[model samples]
Structure formats: structure tokens, C-alpha cells
Target: MGRPKYFTPNEVSLHSTLGDLWVSYLGKVYNLTPLVEEYKGDVLLKPIIECAGKDISHWFDPKTKDILTHVDPLSGCVKYYTPRGRFVHVPPPCPRTDWCNDFGRPWWKDNRYEVCSEETLDEILKRYLHYNSHAHSYTWKHNGVSLDMSKTLSENGIPDEDEEFFDARMDRDLFSLSICLYFNDDLTEF
Candidate 1:
């Protein structure tokens, strides 16, 4: 009934303390303070401890084996449980390259796009337009709509070169320009 709220990573960081735990997953922010308090003594705390106040998109990614599992201290039974909370939409961090595109092609082989460190939003836009125009082999869609990458980027404001915009779009399940410098190649080697 009200306007949706958004928070920057810095804002989420303000609530990172254990007493006021908050974490971001898939561009959604969740306050896990209550769950942490409830499961204080459970082994489930391990994953939570690792992800508190951080963007946990990778944890939920299908390609990765980063699931949260807990062991019952008394019975030695292992189980998995995710924290429950009132999650708000926030821009998520960039995803891993392997998870960026549907195609099994390596990033370099796909387009050889290199996100420049000093690249402006305009530069990114130009690259997107070029990619969309020339690369017809792959079609990127959001909510079943074939994305007009240029139109979407322009509509969102072209001057925004901050990493936040990229993260936000990814979180919203929008288009992914995994070609950006924000997602470095330091991850798993191809």
C-alpha cells in the first residue's frame, strides 16, 4: 500500500551488528535479529554468522553448494533452515559469471566484454547497445519480455555509473550485464 523502500549496502551495513542482524539475498534485505536470537545455540548459526550484513545471493545460487545446514547438538541430527524475516527489496551484489548467463559458454567466449574500472554509465550503455545489436545469438528476457537493453538502461537514468544500479537490477530479476567490472574474473577459473 506504500511506496517500496530501497537500501544501499551502506545502509544495510548500519544494521550488521549481531543484536541487529541484517542480510541481503537476491536484492532483498532481511532482518535476522529475531531468528539469530531463537537459534543462538544451533549450528545453523555458522552460515548466518558468515552472511550477516552481507549480500548472500551466492548462498542461494543453484550452481553453488553453499546451502545453510544445521546440526542438532543433542540428537546430532543435521537439518537445513533459512531464517525468516520481513524482507525488503534492495539491490543485490553482482552474481558469479557462471551464474550470469544461461548459456554454458565461457564469459570471454561469449563476448569478451571487459568492464572498465573508470567506465561511466554512458560507457556501459554504449557497450550494452553494441552487444544487443551485434550479439543476436542469445536473447535476454525479463518477466517474459525481450529486453530492450538500451531502453531499460536509459529509463533507469544513464548517468548512474555506481555499482549499486547494476546490483539493484540483478536483485530485481532484471537484465544482467555480467560484462561489468563489478563482477571480476577472480572467481572459479574457466
Candidate 2:
């Protein structure tokens, strides 16, 4: 209901992961992370996973506001044209009594998943201090390299690649890029 948030393609690309997947469609950005959690390990998630953090406007029709359709050459039947392969919320090629539609609104149409902007390292540090009031001065580092407070994580050469680890079925915490925070003594504090 507030002002709509805007994000650059580069910023969106930073969230490409099962833990934080995002995609833009019809000029609207969506955080499909919940969908991934709900339908984890489903093959239908393959296409969506493959397109994480990228624009999926081509996956949808501009006018219909839905996935594009094509006539099947084999059966001459109309079906959702998913060149990337069928994904979640997309009904099967044929009617099935077992198909459940109780999910209410589909992920694409739900506005709750719409995303916003990001913050710089300095802003994040401020937030950290806000939560940890006992902290005085602080130093942020990635890969043992001191971070430039004015720059973002990506701008500082730290790419969020949790998705790659997830796709490889590896534990993220085991090999995740962690930002180390060193508490500095406030020499002037009185």
C-alpha cells in the first residue's frame, strides 16, 4: 500500500538462491522464497530455480497476465508454453481430479511477496548497533578483508552465492561467506 519499491537488475541478481530467490515479471519483482520452502524438492521448481533472481517477464503474457500458451503439435491441444519446463502453480497439461487449488492466490498474483530495496554496509552496521546497544565501535570484514562502509556487499566484492551451494546440495553454513564484525574500543567514551 505504501510507495512501490524499485530494484536494479544487479540488485535483484544478488538474491538468486533457494533461501532468497527473486524474479521480476511484468515489471513487478516477486520474492518466491516461500514457494520454494513450501514445495521443496519438487521437480516443478526446477524452472523457477533455474531462473532465480532474473526477470521472468517472458514466462508470462503481457495481456493475460499469466503464463503464455501454445498449441501442442502432438495432440493439437492448448497448453501453457513453458519452454523452461512446467513449474509450480501451473496446472497440468490435462485435467486431473487430484489437482488441488486450495492455495488461494497463486504466487505470481500475490502481492505479499513483492520485494523492496537494499542497504549499504554502513546502514547494516547501524542496524547491528541498534540491536546490540552494548557495542561501541565496530569493524566489518569479509574474507578477512575490511569492508568499505560506504559500499554494499556486492560492491565490496562479496557475492551472495547461497543458491549455488543449495543447488549443489551442500550445507550453506559450512562454506558460507561470513562477514566478521570486530568490536573496537571506544577510546573517547567517558
Candidate 3:
């Protein structure tokens, strides 16, 4: 069978949407099922893989057993790996919030901040690869997806250097998914 083609990383909604899907920030659904109640980045995969019913397991994870450790390759977050099946969540915000790595300058400046561990990096890269080639514009996807104009830069809050950085998130900061979360999927066996 042919591989699935994804919308290009240009699609802000799609990029942001799928990025969130890979690592949700809100909360997990009640039980577990592919009928994910969370929009994106809602800890859907791990819960579904760990506590979900048997129906949708195959589509998400079957033999994978633990899903929390599963992260998107392109998401660019990482942490230490433990045998307990516990994996770390490594979205950009985590490094900044928890590790204080994002205090000054854009994240691209520091190698330490980029250290999402070797394994975790590989995983995120693989997931990101799923959409690198596909031609779709994130710019169009972000349009009115769930935008709030009032909260964009506060009277040109974007500095000259920072503008380029923030702009990458959404179309002109309109849909900046600046805040996101990761999952601690139940990869470990009890």
C-alpha cells in the first residue's frame, strides 16, 4: 500500500493541529477510544493505547503496549528514559517552563535546549517526517481555525528578532499555539 500523504508543514492549522495531536496539553478523555474527545494535544494516544477499548487500538497502537512514550518526531522535545515505561514529554514550552531553557533568545540558539535525548529525538523526527514532503500551507489552515485577534502582540509586542520566531507558530501570531503540553503515556508495565 502507498504511504499516507500529509498536508505540508505550511498549513498552520494542520501543523499546529497535528503537532498538538501528537502531544496534547488539555486532559485525557474519560476512558479511552479513538473517538478522542480532545481536539489536539489532549493526551489521546497514550490513554487510547493504554486504557482504551480494543476496537481502535489497531489504528493507534496494538502491540505497542505503552503509548505515553510515543511522541512526534518533529515536535522537538525530549527527556530521560526509564525502564518503567515512563517517557518524558518534550514540547518547546516544557524546556522553557520546566528547565528554564527558553528564557532568552529563540530556542534555536542553544544545543542544551535541543537535547531531547537521542531516542526521543529520533522518535520526534520520525513522526515529523510524515509531513515534510507533502505540499500544504499551514498559513491557510490557521485562518479562523480558532483565532483570537485581541490577544496577539500587545502593540507590537514582537521584537524584531522575536518576530521571526513567533511568526513560525501561526499566520502573524493570530494562531500562535505558543502553549502546548506532552503526555506521559502508560508505556511501563505494572
Candidate that would win on TM-score: 2
TM-score of every model? 0.35, 0.57, 0.15
Report the number of the highest-lDDT candidate: 2
What's the CA RMSD of model 2 in angstroms? 10.5
- The digit string of per-residue lDDT tens for model 3 on 1-190 reads 5322222223212312222222111111112111233223444234333422222111222222222243445665543222233212223323354443333532112233211111222233345547642211122113234222233222223322323433353233243433122323434322
Residue 91, candidate 2: alpha-carbon lDDT = 89
TM-score of 2: 0.57
Off by over 4 Å in 2: 1-4, 116-190
For residues 92-148, what per-residue lDDT tens digits would candidate 1 score against the true structure? 123344332333542212222221122333444455556554333344443444445
Please identify which of the two predictions, 2 or 3, would achieve the higher TM-score against the true structure: 2
Instruction: Flag regions of model 3 displaced more than 4 Å.
Output: 15-190
Q: Per-residue lDDT tens digits of candidate 2, residues 73-131?
A: 98899898999888888888888998787888878878899876446776665555667
lDDT of each: 0.47, 0.78, 0.28
- The weakest ten consecutive residues by lDDT in model 1 span 85-94
TM-score winner, 1 or 3: 1
